[model samples]
Target: MVKGYSNHEEQVFTKIAELRTSNYDSKSINDKIAENQNFSGIIGSLNLTVENYPELKANEEYKRLSENLVIIEDEIALSRKYYNGTIRDYQKFTQMFPNNLLAKLLKSPEFLMFEISENEKENIKI
Candidate 1:
């Protein structure tokens, strides 16, 4: 679980870096979003496993890491909220009046709202 946690952490970081360098085009954004969710799922599994072990859960290092993870989770949630809000505003503008015509002419790509996968909504198998 520790190794998987570390591996996933690296993958999430790498994906974010790639997205930034790739100009955050639709494909890059989507990939980073997928990686973010995948990494969250991996952490969920780790937490589930830890829940069944009282000693490990009580460990100082584990507790500290868990606290940090919670902080990151909060930040990610906020980011998703902001991203979706921006998308809503963008869609409203792009779908209205003369702006719609200009948007169509520019071939602007549509952005999708961040959504959870079915697997993410499922209970993790121990």
Candidate 2:
């Protein structure tokens, strides 16, 4: 599970770097991030396996890694929330009366929110 999660994280970081270098728009980048089926699948599988084999949770290393994973997941969730909040603020500012006129005149691009897919929200079960 650790190895799989590590590989998934590496792949995701690589993809994000590639997208940034390719000058993909924010919406495209956000969509790509949200559409990571491979990573999600790995996470779901890990969760299911852990649920099925409760003894594995008793292993010291497994317990340590699981705690770390939970911390990392929490951090990621907080970051996503922050990103979405920033996008919301930007959207509101751009759409306000005077700001809307200015944005139109300047042809400002719309900011895209970091969105989670419905599948991503579903809990994993064996």
Candidate 3:
């Protein structure tokens, strides 16, 4: 049962990543990426939970499954942090006074950057 859950989590994570790369640069990509981050976080917590539970850890089969989960969890956490940092830089660029003036003249609207969502703040435990 636990093994099945672990596999499903990995599959979902891979699917979300594939969708993200394929849809990259679209107007809606920002929101989608934010959503992906939340899902990734949830997945990480689940993986960590499996690790902290001693019975699961003692089982050799579960231990093998958990090794992959730990690595993937770290990867997801780093990715989310990187995305947030990139968004911060982009937001700062558009807000600069000189850039704002040029952006207005050039008819370039401000980028709708990714923000950590309210649900993420509330439900996400990572």
Query: Relative to the true structure, how large is the alpha-carbon lDDT of every model?
Result: 0.74, 0.67, 0.63
Give Cα distance to truth, residue 37, candidate 3, Å. Answer: 4.3
lDDT of 3 by residue, 1-126 (tens): 667656866876786677567645773755666666666566555655665555665788766766776686567567767867877787788679998777678886444444565644453222
**Ranking of predictions according to lDDT:** 1, 2, 3
lDDT of 2 at 4: 58
Name the runs in model 2 displaced over 4 angstroms: 1-28, 35-38, 117-126
Best by TM-score: 1
46-122: candidate 2 lDDT, tens digit per residue:
66656756666678987797777678767877987997788888889989999999999999876566666687677
**Clashes per candidate, residues 3 or more apart or on different chains:** 0, 0, 0
Could you give me the TM-score of model 3 versus the true structure?
0.51
Instruction: Give per-model TM-scores.
Output: 0.70, 0.60, 0.51
Q: In candidate 3, list every pair of residues with a backbone clash.
A: none
Candidate 1, residues 88-107, lDDT tens digits: the string is 99999999999999999999
Which scores greater on TM-score, model 1 or model 2?
A: 1
Best by lDDT: 1
> How far off is residue 10 in model 1, in Å?
12
Stretches off by above 4 angstroms in model 3 are 1-27, 41-57, 105-126
